[model samples]
Target chain A: MIRRRFPWLSYLVVVTGAVLTVVPFLDMVMTSFKGAGEAGTLPYHFLPKAFDLSNYRAAIDQLDLPVLFRNSVVATAVITGSVLFTSSLAGYALAKLRFPGRNLIFRLVLSTMMFPPFLFFIPHFLILVHWPLAGGNDLFGRGGAGLTVSIAALAMPFLVNGFGIFLMRQFMVSIPDEVLEAARIDGAGEFAVWWRIVVPQTRPVLLTLGLLTFVQAWNEYIWALLISTANPDVMTLPVGIQFLQDYVDPTRTMPIVMAGLVLSILPVLILFLLLQKYYIRGVMLSGLK
Target chain B: MVNALTPTTTERAAPSTRSSSPAVDGRARSRRRQAVVAYLFLAPTLLFFAVFLILPLGFALLLSMSRWAGFDLGGIQPVGTDNFAGLFADGSTFLAPILTNTLLFALGTVVLALAGSVVVATCIDNLRFQGLWRTLYFLPIVTTVVAVGNVWKYMYEPGGLVNGVLNALGLGSMAFLQDPDTALPSVVVVQAWASVGSAVLILTAGLKSIPESYYEAAALDGAGPLTVFWKITLPLLRPSLLLVCITQFISGLQSFALITVMTKGGPGDATNVAALEMYRQAFSYGRWGPASAAAFVLFVVVLVVTLAQLWIFRRKEEDA
Candidate 1:
């Protein structure tokens, strides 16, 4: 009918949505480039009068951004690796293997998903304090807070994700049983089957989980702030940037904060660009059920 | 002939007996081996869960029942339900407003994001450069929330870009984050903007899953665009819509970074959500007992709402 004849209205809607989404980001970029004096001016200009890189340079110096970036990278990498390794293995077992208490274990893992992390803050903090690692006391095991003030603490809490296990299990269940049976018939060991057979088949899911884990760990703030308070060297990018907001002099530090924001954002943006297809697939798969 | 057959049959039978027995035994052994390997593979994940999730959750419950000063190592005295009671009594001053704000914010965000996503999804679904539009719409979802919050923090600054645009359009500048009246709503809008991308992605997938024949048939029936959308598109999209609602609710309730960065529960606690309030109590005010109680409340709220939504959706699906 006439409805299908002209779709320009649809095009208009797309353009409007795109513009609405893009404009704020463009503004952020422009504001970052603007001088501190020009930042507070009314009728905000889309383009800076004179572009400035001083903010980036100053922010790098002021925030000690290199240290923060390194800490974030190390923590995020460790956490992501741990989560991927642990969750995939658990997920494979849950989906493929017959074991006693399999359903019980699966249910327990799923139940963990419902428990809000905030509830555990006080005790988890105390647990970290009394952990026998770096902050442990003179009695060795009795003395220290373990990894509390170290980068390890940042990675430790999120090393196992119930959601990751769930997602991986769902993906693994979709694999054809014949393929697995063939591997078994070929005299492949279980580990070998998981490594050579299941892992290869499950790369997409792994990558999806990896990206999600990386993003979550990278953006995490509160836990990082709480656990890493004793060691400035272990502070992450989000916490570092947040501290910069209040620590930097309001007048002169605006640009530096903006630069920090830009630098902190670049990795995720680059990641999305590189893996947009898989990201979208992951989103659809996880979100739509 | 009988003598020759006996020799051949004996030779064949001996080999078959020899081969089949080992094969069966090997199969059984390998089955046990497979189970062992599976458990081995699962050990690391199970260990992690036991230590971090299970132990911490159990300890957290215990902590919620005790009194904890900021630095009390050996002084976690059992206080029974005092913390929970204290939280509920005077907690309303902080908790009530925060809860109300959170619910209001979540409702606003879910409704706006859903509408915007549907419109955008429908538009992109019909577009020629579909991937380009999808990427454009999805850009915000990938950008770190901290970065988004920071940028929007600037955007919401008094006489900042948002106000500048308004003033340029002959409207006066509004204190988007400073004024009590506008603060939470402003945060809600920002959240809605950040969230629409993911919602759009899901809705787009939902739209794609609708068979082309339905639309074709509807076109043959002389149905208009609105009529087709109402009758055909929406009915099929119930599942995705339900998902979007539940996810948005959870995320909104858990929202902290944006509020912490943007307002810090300011303009006289105008935008203090339960999650942020928990952070404030535990970290800022050093009221561990009260904070734990608040956190438990938040956990309960999230759990209850999520289950209720799931149940409602399940019932709807059953009826359909």
Candidate 2:
């Protein structure tokens, strides 16, 4: 009775909010199936008159889904892999090893989080544009487009995440030093101990960090948008979809855009559903969206 | 720099040669080895920060203060404080509408999301299948901003779902995103909608930490439900509430992705925020100096607002 009150008012409010939250997605799906001239019309219909499969094909063809999908997959994989590798390494050093300037380095990691990402967009773009010896640029980074034309541009700035390092170090701190000492006495090297003991011990946390990094890296828009604008070869899914949305005739292509959006979000949606516990715990720990 | 490596090499060699006391020497050698290994582990991350973080910052600082219109890095001509001055130089739109719109957008999102999440979180706490309900709420968050923005943008059309509902209720259809007055609010609602799920997640955790015995005591005292909520739940939920507000404010201040996707700061800059303006200045018009200046200005605003929020919350906590 204390906790399980059947407050019908609460039910009404929650259900109403839930319906409001969900109806847009339903509208998107329904609108995706609407035939030409059916969408964005007078007296909006909640359901489509016909279940059209042509929109999906049009989206796939017009957006070049395969290339965009490949780019996105590669970018996400590179970012997630690099962040995991760097964060784990830096985190192990910060948490367990006693090196000179350890506290200073840890504080630097924390300070990096406070500087917002928007501050870096302009300069990061410029740096990529002037990155010494890539994409026909000379050693002075002149006469060429530099790294902006490369596929690595999408994943470069985000390869080392300060928050990921912080999260990893916080988790790794509770690992007993005695176990590490035991391994050391047993002739295990530092690299072996970190790889075999520290990593396996922090599997769940690593998963949480990895999933957080994955979703973030996958859905990254502004940087990807900038890079894709510089060179179309590295366009990720969101950038490609937005490009279609902008350049194509919206009246005819709205359904196609919706189709593309649905396709783009499917991977993250499935992952979120499957591993929400880890994702939620990640959010709780980081307090970041 | 070359000389600095001399001591490291000598120190490393000393660990092996100081074998007068074998046991102490062994421990010292291991410690030295561990330090080397730690430095090895930290090398890549430190290198990344040096190139990506520190260099970009110095470059941004230079660009913000200089006038470099084109792609030529060497063509930069330093014009100290002029870019910052131009942002507020009488004819500027930076101070009045863009920054003002940023504040309003952020404030509107925080209010709408906080109210919505607080209600839903408290209600969900009393309900079964909380995980299911939470998963449903979290759908928008996992989805990309392009999807969220476009779906809602389509729904905000004259014949869209919102206007359709209005028309069904015998009201006239409003041009939601087209008009200057309604454009910012329309985008604000979408921003609030997209962010409410995370706020709910945080608030639910906050609610779970509240002791159940407090509720029982309130029940024994014959206090009503609303009273219990006002007195007990609201006060205890302050920290989570502050966190949600600050994070939302910070994100809301700079998040032009949704704005870019939905309205693109349309209807004559009705929905233009500082970040978007900065983006357009750099990318669209090639005004690198003013764009980087705008970026710095917006960063300062974010920093000031966040610190002010912390101060206000801390003071309130002290008073309480």
Candidate 3:
């Protein structure tokens, strides 16, 4: 009776909150369509005077959207692919393989999650800058820009995520030993067994991990900013968009920036919506963010 | 029960059987083969950790205790605790506003997010189309901080949606980011708004676990919604609440990317936090030594808060 009565209050609150949450995104879209002086003016207009496509053109021309999109896709693909491959490989070893120091290695993998990522920004950059023989550096990691001048710098530090490995291992632990043992006794190598049995069974988790990594790598800004500051050719979408806001006058270019944001976020938005089930499961499993 | 019993039975039978010596040798060989295969599988990940993780920690530690111009490794001057000392020296903002702002920013976000999530989660419990509402709330989480910060920054302008609403509601337009007083809180509001969805997700899970019978009994007893909530929901929801609180606090403390996107710790360090200060010190000013020291200081703060939460949660679990 309590649940049935006065549900109007619940509807009002939920709908209001949902609107508030969705309005900014709607504003971003509408503002993207807004013309010069239509946005960020003394009197706000929710709808644009005319639905303009010029901002989209201007955003592409000014921000080099194609290059940025290419960089973003490459980085995201590399990260997602590497994370999935490494996580599954290492997860299989930890879950099923018998070895000395197995427990110690698993503990180490778990402990890696304890270190906050901010701690690594300085050292990771330095290590990349000093990476020997990559970007004209000497064997002793000196006399050159090292790897920072290359696109790999954007994807290097994030290649192996501890949490991905941990998530994969936890899920993989449930696979019955008999499944692998049966394959093993039938003359299949460990690699064959893993590829044939374990990999197929773990597809759902792999998709979840891949989506999570893809979204994160796509949205990563600060590190991309740092790397692209060294070489602009590797600038991802977020970095490129931020670069516009940093240098270009916002009053004149706010709409273009908004347009760029709309375009930039579209890929992730579409991917997330399409695969939200897997991604949401990933979040529920992570519980940390 | 059978599944549970099989593992123990197999374990007990393994050592009791004395198989042939050749079989034992074959088992040993297979075990060695498995170990080799395992290491082969883990090679890439382990190598990455050795270079990226182990090496970086040692390097950061060395850099913190020493001074480097970020060019020549051989030129690093070991200065002991001087970098850490300089951060706390008189006239340093590291101790006063930056660290202070960091704490306040984190605490404010946690409080606002926790409150908003509790209300929304509770209300949402009685609603239809809950998934739709949650997905709507989750839009900002998926969007890049670049988009989130810029949209919010524009909205903070006098001609933006927020101020327009203020005017419509008979309130004066306020300088959200320009004024030092409101800058931090404005950013806090955005952060809370962005994070409230996840908190709600957690709290909703918590809410669903509280038995409906409690509410039924409360209704029969003529208790009000607020009272039933306080007496039943809040108490049962403490675990999830604390989980949300501690995690949000930790992330809030570490977060500066949105700040970088929005204000860049501007208005004369009014919104500056420790992590952003550390970033500026290293990247902008090229003060690698002090920056590394700042990183360590912030790391210790985060570690202490995390450990304290764990301790408190453990104690609470024991009590429960």
Candidate 4:
């Protein structure tokens, strides 16, 4: 039926949608180069009257891009590593392992999904203040902000993901038990079986989880804002861009802000381009389950 | 009784064989070993959850019950249920309106995005450049929220492209992000645009799973396209629709960054959803109690809605 009439409608819709989506991005890039006067002018210039790199230059000079980028990278890497390793292991165990309290634990994990994250902010902040760790004081750890102002605080909260575990478990459950038994018969230990046999088998899932964790961690703003506010040195890109907006003069800042936004998002865009297939698959898999 | 007799006879005959063989013992030992390995594999995850998720959730519940400004150690006081009281007490002034707006925004976006995605997906499903369309639509989802927010902020400026286009089309420029009436809806449009790709993908997958035989059968029965879609497509696509609706609901409720960047709940607390409101109260107003209360309220609403949806989905699955 679709093949008969209105075949051109499909092409028109696809082209129109594609143009609508990409035009904003193109506008962003063009606006990043336009002066403030030219930016707010009428009729919306598709191409900049004068191509200027000053906005990019000024943004780099004004904002702590390198430090923020490093912080973002470190935090995202740690959180991704921890989530992938832990979720995969937990997922495998939930899928294949038989234990006394396995079902109970799995159920508990599932139930945690009901708890909204906003509910934890107040308590988590208080706990961070009194956390007994490296920066913790002698009693109740009240002197210094224990986990409050560090990159560790930024990364620590998201290390254990219930969704990640659930996703991995669903994927792992489809794997045959015979493979594990064969590995066991060959005298491979549990860790060996998981590392050599199971881990290799779940590569696609791991990639999906890794890309997701990276994007999420990189884009995290609220927690980063809360924990890293005291330390200007450790701000991530999102928080940095936010603060940059406040510091820059609005009349002259539009271009720089746009430039900073472009800079901030480049990594994510590149990451998406490289791993979009895995990302889409992961979303479908996790969303379906 | 027959099974028991057979098993006993077989066991008696195989006793010598079983006793002589190491494979059975090996199997038992391997099982024990596997159990040990399973625990080993679970250790890191369990430990992380214990310290991070479990402990923090426990602490969050405790904090909700107490009155702490979150900064000072000397002012920690246990004021049980007071925070929750403040949530409802303040509901009349700002919380009620914000909650209504948020829920309304969520519903609007979900419905709009669902409709948009279905149409776009159906159209794209038969297109030649499937990959190109998918990439273009999905681009917004991949873009960082801050970047997208900033771009949209530009687009929403008084003389920007949106207003420019509006004016060009013979309609006067509307106060998209400035006016209270249009701000929330403007944000909704952006959110819908950002989310439609994923919804399309999920619905497309659902559509693909429907056997072509049904369509063939429908066509042979002289059913119109709209009839087939309504009768055949909608019913089989219920699961995906439900998933998209619930996920988009949760996402729309928790939304903050875009609003923060675009409007900052602007023009007199117009776009202040609970999450953004909580941030403002806590960081801007230093009203720890009120913010915590707001957070708890938001949490409850989301939890209840999500659970209700889950229950509905489960019931539907069972019926199927």
Candidate 5:
């Protein structure tokens, strides 16, 4: 009733805020349709003169969209699958199984989340560069470009997520112990019990963790940029588009960059929209993006 | 299946029963096996931590103290405290512009996003299609930083939408990201804009948790909407406000991806922050020692704030 009293004001504020929120995306879409010299011109126009589709063609052709797409998809899939599998398995173990030093391991996992990720960029890159025997390095991890040249570099540092394991463990802790105990008593091994019973029971949290990891890995840029810069052969969608923007002329290529961005963002946008409930819950659980 | 399982299971059982202590021995053996299985399941994750988490940390610390030019571990020259000293030494931009810029950027984002989210979220709680509004707001959050940064960068250009709006209003267009004075704030605005969605979500959740009866009681007392918000909403929303505040502050402190995409920390380092500086030091300049030291300095700032937040929240929990 209190909120109802100023309904007009509320409507005005909410509508205004929503428009402000959506306008950049709308502008990006509109700019992608602008013809050459039409964007970044004397007067900015909200809409294109005509709905041109040529920029998408240029983006695909010039930016090597296929290779970028392949790299992005492979990296995202590997990171997501690895995170989900590892999180679920480790979660089950930490939650249900008896083990020595379990407390210490759990604390270690929690502390891992506390360390800011920026601290790792320098060392992680160096570690990959010195990875022995991969990329022509020696036994001591020296004297070559190392693993940075390979596609696995895109997924390496992201594969094991501490937060994912923590989320899975928290969710699994709620599952009644008797279900696992029953499976175990029925001659089921720990692996089979986790695979059949725990995994299915914890499917919702897994989906949440999976979607979170998928979105993050898909949109990840810095490490991908670093890795792609080290070896151009492993460029992902974001890295490729950014590289093009950095090197090419902005005026002639702005629309194409916009087109590439539109294409690059569509997968995550669609995925988030379809499974937004899970994604939103995951955000809330994590408390920040 | 029975025939296949019979031999191995009997073999496993026979060893425990040989001393006529079947129950105790069997339980102990199974517990040990479970422990082994648990560790086996955890092997990959632990190995990853050993390499990525633990090793990187030790290496980062070591590198912070030693000068090395991008290659060969054997070339590291030990120079104790020099890297840290250089950051704060005379004629160093690290103390004045870089670290100060980082703090100001984080503080500005938290303030702007918090104010905006409070107003928008409180209003949206009473509106229909809340999910749609939330989803719309969350687009930037789901978006790659490259897209958000570039879009905002273009919009801040001379002939772009933001300036276009300014000219339409009979105002001169200003260079947002190019000017030293405006560059940091320009990026801060984008950061706040991109983050407001999640803040709104958290605050709205907080608003929902407040009992509707409080509003009803206020309405009966002839309280104005402003009075109701001030008296009831603000007090009850403190926890969520603090949550958004500290989390956003932490994220703001560490985030350099957007900055990298937008300005790459310059029109002469005008927009440079600690993390970006650290990144450039290593990646661009190949000064591994100084870069690692910058990272540790930034880490100490982040750690202090994080610990303060934890302590504050814990104290609040205890009081509650």
Candidate 6:
């Protein structure tokens, strides 16, 4: 009844907010089609004169969209795959397996989340550059460009997410011990029980974690930017697009950058739309994005 | 999420199979093997934490104390307290503009997003198609900061939509990011806009947890909508509100991605924040020692703010 009293007002507020939320994206899409000089000029039209698709073509050609796409895909896949596998494995151990120092390790995993990510940026970059032996670095981690030139740099710092492990562990705790014990009694090893029982049952959390990790990895900018700057060959979409933005003439190439961005975010947008339930659940579980 | 934010009760209370342990030979052998297997499962994660988490932290501390160029570990010259002192030294922008902007940026974001999300969340609690509305709000959250930052940057440009709208309304067009006075706040608005969706999600969940009878009772007592929100909803939603507040505040303090994409802390360092400064110091300027110092300072700020936030929240609950 209280809600019923202000129905129109509520709709007005929500719709207004929705328009505010969606307008920037609509502008981005429209601007992607705007012919050169038509955008970033006097009057700042909301719609393009014609929905020309040349910007997308230019974005692909100049920005090397395919290389960027492959790098993003590889990095996202590696990060997501690593996060899932390691999270599930560690989560199983923490949740079900009997062990010494289990409490310490679990607490360590929890404490990892306490450290803000920015603190690690400098050291992570340094260590990777000096990472013993890879990228022509010696055992003492001296000499070449290090792993920063490789695709692995895009995914390394993110491979083992503390939150992912914590999430998986929390969910795995819910799986009845009876199922696990029965499996063990049936002579199943701990690894087999984890693979056969815990993982299959925890599919929902996995999907949630996977989607979260995938989007995060795909959208990761600062690390990718750092690494990409070192070796442009490994540049991800965000970095490549930004590089183009940084180097190009904004008035002439704004549409191209917009087109690149639209293409860059498309995979993630579609994935999030399709699996949004799991993604939202992950955010709900994790609290902050 | 509220539960997850808290130390998990299940960690201590649930899923431990150790209660059935006995001295039987099979059990003893299995226990040994189980420990081995558990360690095996945990090895990769432990190794990663050791290398990435623990080692990096230790290395960061070292770098904060030593002066070194980008390359060569041996090039590090030990200079104790110099880096830390330099940040606060005379004529250092680190103290005045950078750290101050960081705090202001973070504070502004928390306030704006909190206000917006609360209003929208409360309204959405009464609406149909709540999921659809939430999904719309959450688009920015799923989008990369590049897209969010660049779009807003262009919009704030002289020839962009924001100024376009202003000119259409018979008002003057202004340079948003270029003006020193308006630059920080301009980026802050984008940060708040991008982050509001998740805060709404948390607050909506908070709103759902309130029993319907309370609102029903308020209605019977002739309380108006505003009074209902102020008296009943606000008090009931405090936990979730506080949850949103703390989480957003922590994130806001460290979030420089949007700033990087939009302003690059430019126009005479008007929009520079601590994290971005730290990033530029290390990567852009090759000042690793002072960069790490800035990072340590920033990390301590985050810690202090988080603790202070918790204390303030605790005091509020007590006062209530």
Q: What is the C-alpha lDDT of each candidate?
A: 0.79, 0.90, 0.89, 0.78, 0.92, 0.90
What TM-score fits each model? 0.91, 0.96, 0.96, 0.91, 0.97, 0.95
For model 2, what is the alpha-carbon lDDT of residue B228? 86
Q: Report the C-alpha lDDT of model 5 over B151-182, residue by residue, as the tens digit.
A: 89999999799999999999999999999889
Q: Which candidate number would show the highest TM-score if scored against the true structure? A: 5
lDDT of 5 by residue, A203-269 (tens): 8899999999999999999999999988898899999998888899988888999999999999999
Candidate 6 CAPRI category: medium
- Residue lDDT tens for model 2, A230-285: 99989999999989989988878899999999899999999999999999899889
Task: Sort every candidate by DockQ, greatest first.
Answer: 5, 6, 3, 2, 1, 4
Q: Which of the two, 1 or 3, has more lDDT?
A: 3
Model with the higher TM-score, candidate 1 or 2: 2
Off by over 4 Å in 5: B1-12, B15-20
What does candidate 3's lDDT look like per residue over A179-233, in tens digits? 7776765668889999999999999999999998999999999999999999999
Chain A TM-score compared with the true chain A, each model in order: 0.90, 0.98, 0.98, 0.93, 0.98, 0.98
The residue-by-residue lDDT of candidate 4 on B132-185, one tens digit each, is 678778888877777777778778886677887887789888888888898989
For model 6, the chain A TM-score is 0.98
**Candidate 3 has which clashing residue pairs, if any?**
none
Model 1 misplaced stretches (Cα beyond 4 Å): A1-6, A138-145, A176-178, A181-187, B1-32
Regarding DockQ, does 2 or 4 come out ahead? 2
DockQ (0 to 1) for model 5? 0.61
User: lDDT score of model 5?
Assistant: 0.92
Measured with C-alpha atoms, the lDDT of residue B303 in candidate 5 is 100
Question: What lDDT tens digits, residue by residue, belong to model 4 across residues A5-46?
Answer: 355877787677778778789888888899868877776667
